[model samples]
Target: MNTISYRWMTSLVFVLFAGLLGAWSAADASELPALNITQVSENVFSAIGATAAPSRDNFGHNNNLSFVITEGGVVVVNGGDNVLLAAALHRAIEERTDKPVRYVINENGQGHAFLGNSYWSDLGVTIIAQREAIEEIKAHGEASLSQMRARMGPVVTDARVVVPDVAVDDHYVLELASEPIELRRFGAAHSPGDLSVWLPKQRILIAGDIAFHERLLGIFPDSDVDAWIDSFDVMASLNPVVVIPGHGHPTDIETLRYFTQGYLQFLRDEIEVILDDDGGLSDAYEIDQSAYESLDTFDELARKNAGRLFRQMEEKLFQ
Candidate 1:
């Protein structure tokens, strides 16, 4: 088999094995919530998180937590949403290899991305994030902790706001591993300081919140849809053979394009039509998002996303 097909089949086999093991795997003996781990490549693995909103059941694990085992050590992506989840992920890593976790890279400053830094920080793991992400964490980390506490209660009692040890501007090449991992921030995306972890040698991209496959991408108050499209285009230019997204299972670039950029463009196009016709925000909300109705979180975010984009477009038009 070709190299690409071999890697894909290997990953598929691991996924099927994980599925057969069920949601709560052997890691449950550690008394922590077990993540569904999927092998992406030879040394790369990802713990797929729940697609639903953060809650007591999922322990605020609403985003993917991934890791790469390298000759130097293991590098983790997304500290997880809280201490327990991070600890749980660590336990799973231990089960795989004996390499110590050398670094934890936060994809962004969002709670699900960096809140678990408390766990890694306590262990003296070097943490890394984009400069803007560090600033976002410094400014809003406490608020994110409070929100997780409210949603998860005692589960997040040990969770605290912890910033990264290293902050890079737009690009940072992490070389501790045999296969150097490149962390790059294209621009404004799903959230501030969003970045993707690119394994050039493997042609696999761990796209943080920049790409969403199974779920509907959220448009936050600060999100710039226009810039997001531009950023997605830049990231897509890499032609990744495999894509591990922030909130879904390991997928391909085409799937991300269909669900993320395609969805955003569809909403923006619909909103532009409404604005040109002198329609109101309510009309924007009623735009046909049925095509995306099958996606996770569509019920919770579809109309809200449309309304937010409408306001954003309207503000830009008047500006």
Candidate 2:
């Protein structure tokens, strides 16, 4: 582990210890999810999302938002689901640092990732993402925003769709606020253009939707189970000390191994067994998933994940 400077460490400690007391106070006065900042490292802080579904009570802020303070300024990981939620996150970061937000990364192609772009755009902060993410937003951003507005109502007010300012086809590395940030795309996992933000020096990983902790990893129409599994291997290779997943609290790699990677592997193994037995999607869904039953959104996503994995595995068999 890299040794952190004493002064910097003290600042981090202050942020970690003192930040919590003032964390929830910075969010908007409206009914948005209360944002709390936790100092994960000397330079890293995160506003964890609700592990449960977005309701009028939580205001669709059920996604993680993180910021890394660099010597130059701050680099935000993922923007929140809507404008107001993003505004609340902005307030939290503002409370901690006087430096500007130098960069904002919409980690994946999901609508929630990019919908908050307008808020940052007005401040002249450069938004970055994978080319595939830009494409995904262009194709589905409006519809997704409309659906989210209808579902969350006032929480997403003033939320407008904005494409990233900078889009890259592969890895993009640069020095932001005097700190190095490597943005990598590990093929399709959660979506066609999922991205992971790696701080090489800190060994901190902001692992978008590619890894979910307690919450059930989603399997959307654009998701690929096989690729998602491969991406887990890629994440493990980084050996991140702290991982900020898309929808859960920050966790260690070991917890992630068992909860995220292990659970996915178990599902694939079970689905393969069902396929080997000449079973179908229904049978795959019938497999004992009691282990993950207590996880948030298991009821909403587990069977669907099973069905998706089964279809993918079956398709691969023929190919």
Candidate 3:
């Protein structure tokens, strides 16, 4: 397995392109939304999103988006939260290289996964996702879009749901212009159609929402907590050098295992302990979370994640 270093490398392309692009365009890359696009590898750049939720302030760019610049073209992971943000990503790409975006992979059926479809589609890019995710978008995508519109207000007006052209189930591989890319799904983990984009040569695994760094996982009603645990094992099995989380920072498999995977396991164990002790679901609030207390959104998400997992465990055990 190749070891991936998380250190930032100075991108001559980024600096050179930004300089040339600055003279040609009025909008500065820095003037765009709060996203900080940095070159994490030779051909890989990550637009690490904000820790906070989508709002008019941040323009709904709260999910990570990674673009791989290959000789053929570019492949983007996670469409982004809305059109405005996606357009910003488009410009960001323009600042880096002139390669057209060939494909956009929806990591899941979530709002951030496909909301930016229109922008990419307008440019003739084909979107791809797991078959289950396509079904999810068909079922609940409209309602999710409505909720996002209300939360984000005017920023999401242009956002539209565009389903992927290609539907992948277990695994799919693409030989892009420069490298071979692998798309693997870990059976209904974070979302029903959770997909991880892996670049074997780069040893980078874009762990969509399946792995989060120093943040609480959103346990949506349909989410399977047990399956999510198993999915973490699957992610670790890849031994990825760099794991670009669905949210938060790009990190290593160890951090993903301990912080993201370990935290989920800890939540399940604590909830189970409360249940085994004849304590009600409310008792999960008393579990010590001092270790993950400093993590982002810990206060807002910790209790909610605990309650959701407790209820799920209760149903599985009692039923």
Candidate 4:
């Protein structure tokens, strides 16, 4: 670990927290400041959505994040870049219970999922995540944080990126907080491997990137759109009543299919547009964004699902 300047850290925290207690905006709705957390159901908790992504924070919707306060301890799903959000979550957990958080879970390998891991790991909390997430962080965490320092700021880089203490090869079902928890690994969709934290006791599903509320899901360098669409079916299989998305607000099982259909269809349309335009791959990407900006933010995820969607479109066109 590299040593950081304390003065820089203090200044950075202040700059990053300027809006911590302010009003909300749709864009700012993506942050997980402690104030956002709300006890939605019995023993089920989440940091409500906030507007804007933080200066150093990379992912847009670490928002709508949550933790499960089991009788034994609290289990945090996504750590939100690092300790600031993680500590905020820890504060929220304290409000609901005196139980120590025994487990930290990641729904996906995104920075939002694993970056804040140091907080729990330091406290001897067992970190749980998919095999792929562990590998990705090990491969890229440091470099990513270094590059993101300016935008997301110094605290993110100051915090150590952690790997999963427990790696699941396939789906794993276990008990936590005296409740039956289903850690379902539904193949590759949003990333190499995605885990859906299911609380059978509460009938709540933490549907990471598998579903989003009124926003375009990001299909990154590792994402598979078709497989991502299929993952939605997997999310639906549980027939969850209340869902905690990786971003935005809570949603239901019904919206998963609705959003998936729109996402998949939009990809198909872009593929057709790319072929008809007879343009190069890059051109198709640009064209798709201009044409589809009106679709939905989910369609505009990373502002470049357009390119990924276009690449998939081009592949299908050639095939």
Q: Pick the candidate with the highest lDDT.
A: 1
Residue 142 lDDT in candidate 1: 91
Deviating ranges (above 4 Å) for candidate 4: 1-33, 56-61, 152-157, 276-303, 316-319
Each prediction's whole-model lDDT (CA): 0.86, 0.78, 0.79, 0.66
Model 2 C-alpha lDDT per residue in residues 69-126, reported as the tens digit of each score:
8877789987667766676787787678766677899988776688878767765678
lDDT of 4: 0.66
lDDT by residue (217-283, candidate 4, tens digit) is 6677777877777667766887788888766677787776666546666765766766797866666
Q: 1-319, model 3: which lDDT tens digit per residue?
A: 1112111112343344445433214334455575699787988988988787777677677888899998877899988877667768877887887666789999999888888776676556889999999999999889878987787664345456787899999899978866999999876677789998998887898889988876766777788878888888877887888889998888888877887778888888888778888999769867787898877888888788887878888888889
Ordered from best to worst lDDT, the candidate numbers read 1, 3, 2, 4
* Separate clash counts for every candidate: 0, 1, 1, 21
After superposition, which runs of candidate 2 have C-alpha atoms over 4 Å from their true positions?
A: 1-33, 154-158
lDDT of 2 at 93: 79
Off by over 4 Å in 1: 1-29
Q: What TM-score does each of the candidates earn?
A: 0.90, 0.87, 0.88, 0.79
